[model samples]
Target: MQRYFETELLDVKNFELPKEIYKHAIVVMRAKVGDHFELVTADQKVHLMEVTAITKTAATAKEIEVFEQLTELPVETTIVCGLSKGDKAEFIVQKGTELGADHFVFFKGEYSVAKWDDKKQKKKLARLEKIALAAAEQSHRTTIPTVAYLSSLQELTLAADEKGLIAYEEAAKEGEKGALVTLLKEIKVAPKETKRPKLQAIFGPEGGLAFQEVTALEERGYIRAGLGPRIMRAETAPLYLLSSLSFALELR
Candidate 1:
């Protein structure tokens, strides 16, 4: 069934769809009166609704009952990376949303080649947000991840929680174990009575993070870790990290 995220509450009673949604539901999807579909509200609850009336600017639906049981990731994961060139960042946001990232932060790094002015930054963030919303709908995620732009490393570090890891390729070469592995091990060993862990993983741009930046992150209690032996592209690293997380938490 087609799924849509709507802010309005749905009940067995009649309801009207917004103009844009009416076009898609009635004209695009060719749904008619009595057609059924799934709707997820802002509160992350999925409900079944049946179309009652269709109009030029609106469509009405009667909510039947809740559909699937709501299931979410046990741990919240936030991926912060240095802004990279081209459309890679957009791709990262899309795939990251499907893999259960709670939030994304793109920061200006010491070695970052891409620069965005205030106006350009707003546009870029907006585009990334659209990608995230579409991805969330496609993946049936209850919540859409947020994308943010950070001006400096200080701002980026301030967003992290107590459990954070920085994905530095150099760390992998220094005989340190893989970051994904290390984080999983830590989670497994955590006491059941402990609060749910929140993880923020940072990645670098094309040229990677500056040594000074890595040192600064270390000072803030972020462990330096690596993905693997081979150096992955800036765009590909986040996807790799997100997949690892999904396998550890969701697939297991």
Candidate 2:
């Protein structure tokens, strides 16, 4: 069944699908009256819905069942990456959303070769947002991950107040390991009255982070950690970190 994230589904006899969703549902998917799909509302509740009626431009659906389950990460994880060249940003956002990232933050690093002009920045971000939405829907995620742009590493660090880990290549060279596992264990346990803890991991661009950049981040409470002994590209590091997190938190 198709799944859509809908902000309006409260106390309504019938809910109208948005224009994008309607076109895909009716024309693309050939959705008809009595066809079933899933809707995730603003309250983060998943509801089974059936198409009640179809107009020329839109389709209406009614809730049939409310699911009593959730499919989110145990800990809210955000991946921050330095802006890289080519389609690496899109690749990160798309795969990261499917892997259960709560948010994606991109910042301009000192070593970044690609620079986004004002005109290009808006278009690029919109495209990335759409990719995240599509990935979230396909993955059956109740909540779509958000995409953010940061002007600098300082802004990125200030925005994330949780456990911040920098994927430092130097750390890997020095044989640093087990930091992620220890941090995951610490955040995995929370009081009954508290929500899950948040974690943010930062990765550098192609040339990697400058020494001064690493020092600044370390001074701001960011822990230097390595994914493994093998060094990864700017795009590969975040995906690697996310996979490790899923294995530790979801599979274990």
Candidate 3:
């Protein structure tokens, strides 16, 4: 059952696939009239629809059945990572989406090696978005994660909420437990009847966060926690953080 995220809520009771969708169904999938496939509408509702007519510009499907299932994380977690070099940012977006990241923010930091101009920034953001959407569909996620353009540390901190954590290796050296462990403990102690808190986990780039940047985050109310004794790569850290969050919140 391949799933596609459509822009509109389809009442396939008497519906037609848009030109792009039609080509994918009729030509790409080689689906013909009477063939059935799973369709996810803009509202995130999943339905079983059968092809009724195939046209040059579109294909029609009749809604046969629907399954109301919700597959989302218990807590909405946004991962804010400092911009890294090369395609590492793209990797973060793709893997982060599969790991159930609700949103992503890339910030230019003092230690960041990659620099993005206006045109380059737009292209990079667009590419990240496409990767996220594909990963979402593959992972059976109802909603695609958002990828934001690079921002400054000041801008990011100003927009952050009270429930955020920043992963800094020095925190562990100071006898603090790993950030993931701390977050899990917090979630476990939270009242079950209460709504889950939104956790934003921030990671630094290859060279890691500068001392001043880390201090700035601390002043902005971000608790600095570490991951482990072994330092993880810039792109790998966020995936690990997100996977741990999903396991703690959703799989628990």
Best by TM-score: 2
- For residues 193-223, what per-residue lDDT tens digits would candidate 3 score against the true structure? 4444677788988889899998887888788
Off by over 4 Å in 1: 10-12, 68-71, 158-161, 189-196
Candidate 3 — which residues are off by over 4 angstroms? 158-162, 173-175, 189-196
The number of the candidate with the highest lDDT is: 2
Q: For model 3, state the Cα shift of residue 115 in Å.
A: 1.3
55-103 in candidate 1: lDDT tens per residue? Answer: 7767889888886554555577888989888887898999888888889
CA-lDDT, candidates in order: 0.82, 0.86, 0.79
Better of 1 and 3 by TM-score: 1
Inter-residue clash pairs, candidate 2: none
Query: Candidate 3 — number of clashing residue pairs?
Result: 0
Off by over 4 Å in 2: 158-161, 190-193
